[model samples]
Target: MTRNIWTFITCGLLFSAAAVHAQSADIIISKGTDKTTIDASPFGASDPAGRMFIQVLTADLVRSGWFARGAQGASEYILSGSAGGGGGFVAQCRVAARGRSGTVFDRSYRGDANEVRRLAHEAADDILKALTGRDGMASARIALVGTLSGHKELYMADADGQGLVQLTGHKSVSITPSWHPDGDRLYYTSYAKGFPAIYELNLRGGSIDRVANYAGLNTGGVVSPDGRWMAMILSRDGNPELYVRRMPNGDPVRLTSTRRSAEASPTWSPDSRQIAFVSDMSGRPQVYVVGREGGQPRRLTLRGSENVSPDWGPNGLIAYSSRIGGRYQVCVLDPRSGDVKQITAPDADYEDPSWAPDSRHIAATRSIAYRSSVYLLDTLGDPPVALIDQKGDWTAPAWSPGR
Candidate 1:
């Protein structure tokens, strides 16, 4: 009898261990689709007075919008980070919802003392993606052309519409500013040469260099995330067609073949593997995506009469302006599942929907009731918030990736 009881107890212990292991595996597998409820608090890492790491981590997490910041009550998740001695810091996070622990997401990183802020953001992003299966957008910036005082010039602003600064001093119209992957420079179409031309403007030096000059039209340019190639629309070949050019040296390589369709408003995928742009190949202007290396093109937009200004975000989501219900409105598309969601209704001619760095918000110019203004719509939120009020017209608002 004693031997039998001991055997039973051992078997029960083994079963419990196996169950725990299985639960852990399930959590790991389902993490990508799970939305975690979390709380962030200070974990004992260094001196009590040292909270710089926590500050930076919280800022980064808030900017990412992956989690709803907890106030005081019970939180679904908890995050804590500290910069301790020995030039190393530890960021530990726990996610819990209702009564279940989501996952054990933690990391310890070591780097130069001056890189603490960058490291902090990186650590926060890792924790966020590990727990929530989404990357943080705290380190991205946006480039767009803002019109002021009857002059259209290039302007760079933060993703939240703050810190607006004019990038180009040209009196002519400048539009379609694309940022290099490093966020150190901007390439835009400036009319300084009597026609739309590509110009590379250094953000650090406030210097501008002409990149591509064509006779007919050169506009709607975008740079690859790797900064190796550029995609733009150039009418130099008699009509607007997609063209790819090598950066810094400005070696041109035409990507499209026919003048049957006007290809413009090119936006690159986050991985730099594909390019999405507006084309009239399907008898009308619609959004189409093609491989970067040149191949067959696939149409994405079909429900709308006309769709233009496609902007690809971090995830597989694409934002564009569509003529729905007799007016131009902003719409979003899930490229993976073919799910289309109309964001802006038929009240105004809303165009140029630029995705925020977080991939959760879109910045666009909306014209309603004979007035135009800049608006920021948090796709994950209930609705959008007006960021700027304009009297005449505020068009082409781009959210900066980050500083």
Candidate 2:
């Protein structure tokens, strides 16, 4: 189909690949700064759902970088709550500093039995915000592409891998799932048409539309945080390069011109003024950044022989997967200092690192024995937590910016 026709189809449709390889590393736990200890009191004395709420909330708090699980022995804070209301599940949660300092959070959440976990997540987010002065990712969702049913399909789950929902039934190769700035819509590449084409799926309305179906390759479509442009990789102009197109409909503006080098995995900085992408212009795949308005590209990584899947976090850290000692591990780079810190141990190959909105934690794919699963790694301290326990090869996790 012609480019014009495809654009028309995408507009009418309303919406939207990453490559994967198998490798292995060791899991190394690093001790960093001390974490705040919070003692969590039990909730819901008589209701089973209330107890479930406390369990889920405790897990969320532990997964959050700011708090560690412990008893009321010398804890900095104490989280106590109760669940009641014979008709439905009602959670009354409160977080207070030890020694009668004050109550940071005192709120009540009411929901049906099916929403017990969600209610707990909401309470956890509020408690985090009240205590740490930072937003919590407990209520956020993550879009991922996995091969669970023998074919690559798009799937989504809560940040903790609960409330799993399958977004696409393409039964074909669907990859590179990206979230709209609003987090209610998603864009991904599906090969159901015998070629890679970008499609958009609306989570609220259950609708799917083709966003970009150009001739060559139409993949890696990430909507800018400002929701005004989309940075994607297209080869219609001869070589696979990064291009930024205005939202809804606008002619794509070519941003990179590395003649023989192919660019993949384009991510926008928090301010939306620059984009970090993967290119092999120097004979090996590495991360590079270029101005959003199209200018000379600047190389970012100097150590890794192969650095790809760059994700620019909201807190100004660029997290990417770097090949070290022949194994791909998650590493974060300070764009301003050129200092790099490897987060994952050399136990298993970790790739496709996506940062949470807080920027202190990262979600990436951990592969071992050729079996892949999504894992959440805290950049501050603590070990990586496996987000999903299901049996599937989950890869390319895109974390939402919280509701």
lDDT of 1: 0.68
Q: Name the best candidate (by lDDT).
A: 2
Q: Write the per-residue lDDT of candidate 1 for residues 1-403, one digit (tens) a residue.
A: 4433433443344345436543111111111122344556645456322355566666666555556567545666666545554544444434344355554665776666555555666667677677677655544545666667567777665443444666788888887777776778777888887877888888888889887887888787678877777888888878888878776667567777766878889998888888998889888999988888888788887665798989898766899998865888776777765555556544568889988765777878788785677777655432456655433456677665533
What are the lDDT scores of the predictions, listed in order?
0.68, 0.84
TM-score of 2: 0.90
Residue 19, model 2: lDDT of: 12
- State in Å the error of residue 195, model 2: 1.4
Q: Model 1, poorest ten-residue lDDT window?
A: 23-32
Clashes of 2: 10
